[model samples]
Target: MHRSTRDIRLAEALVETADTLVDGFEAVHYLPRVADHCVRLLAARAAGFMLIDEDGTVSLTASGTHREVALDLLRAQRGGGPCLDSYSSGRPVPPVSIGAARAAARWPEFTERALAHDIAGTFAVPLRRHERLLGALNVFVATLPPETASPDDAASDDGTELRLAQLIADCAALGLQNHTAYVQCRTLAGQLQQALSSRVRIEQAKGMLAERWNTPADHAFVALRQYARRHQLPLDRVAQAVIDRVADDAELRRGARGGDDGGRA
Candidate 1:
């Protein structure tokens, strides 16, 4: 790709990845798409993502048909590689020539697997949200012969590839945060609805008990609490049972009367 064309394509890819933030895009679905963009715009053989979970274990979250590249990324978490190092240090791992002997020595298993897939160079950047580390993005580029120089070789273009990778990583991180916030909001909404529903049920059960036993609502509540404790049941569940007529109304009446007479249920 020509330098100007490559730059334009990179900008387009960044825009495309950024657009995902506006919708309900899942991290699993979107990160791989970004990886594909990285492969196309970075001229890499394949790309993948490794996510660090709450337990601090890293797992391969997304990849393409390049099974060898995917395997190398997974093994990287265990034995250590550019992706793992980048995620840990919150720094980009610049493109490293896979043909260099030092590369093989640095990441033995990853190098062996990568070389098997004809990958020539590898680059990685941390997926970070501000100061928080999320994961790392890995791009496996085709090897270039010494005679065929890369546009990134120019002093003016130094760190350009790494910067592109970081930009994509930033977009992925934002998508992840958006997804997480959405999930948490959904969970809290569900819990609130359930709580409201349970409260309604409890109130209905109390009214039913008060009418059945000819007792005040507060006395009915005391009866319900005592019966629930005696039966080793949840108060909400006992209330539900009462509302459902699963618990005997006669028994509840007796319990309420007894509780009013100093016998707690």
Candidate 2:
């Protein structure tokens, strides 16, 4: 397969995932989707997902989710896996072999268990958005050495696949960051609209009060606002009541006069 092309596709998929999060993406829901995409584009044989919570503990949100959820969660709890290192350090962890790792047992629990399950090597990469560490993506494979697998066979192409795996991790990070930004903007927009509407109703009430009391519009506005503040009532509700009583649209119109401070009750 075309490795570069596959990597590019993986990046695009990640960006799309990020976009969802922008509009308030859910971790439990989206992580599974990410796992699916990685399985399709990367040469990952089996994949899992994880995220770092506020308490500084990383939790597995989903596992081989597509294949072996049980083993995946076990690796995450044991906590010595490559993904943990990559996430804490904010760098990509290289693919690792079990036989070689026996010297030190990088992830004693994860290594032993995965090896028992017949996986020869594993790749763990982090998912980060901005400085926000989302979690890790873990993959298990059956072989490692190109020479040992088959000098001319497909397993020899693992180098290209490893590069693609890195790209996938990056894409996942970006997706998470993008989602956060989108949710923020949406929340801000809602607040702004509410503020604008409140302002409009308050102005309408001021005009009604001015017409009823036969005084300057600004003075009427000031009295209404002061009353609302004292009563712990919303300024808009007070304005609505004043308008209901007076119903004088002309007095409520804007551009009343210069230097008209509404606080001048």
Per-model lDDT: 0.75, 0.64
- On TM-score, the leading prediction is 1
Q: Please provide TM-scores, in order, for all candidate models, with all chains considered together.
A: 0.76, 0.75
Question: Which RMSD values do the candidates have, in order?
Answer: 5.0, 5.9
Cα miss at 227, model 2 (Å)?
A: 2.8
lDDT per residue for candidate 2 within 132-177, as digits (tens), equals 6777777666644555433322332556666666666677677666
Q: Write the per-residue lDDT of candidate 1 for residues 29-57, one digit (tens) a residue.
A: 77777887776666667888888886987
Off by over 4 Å in 2: 1-15, 21-24, 63-79, 129-132, 143-156, 244-265
Best candidate, lDDT: 1
C-alpha positional error of residue 140 in candidate 2 after TM-score superposition, expressed in Å: 1.6
Give the clash count for each candidate: 0, 6
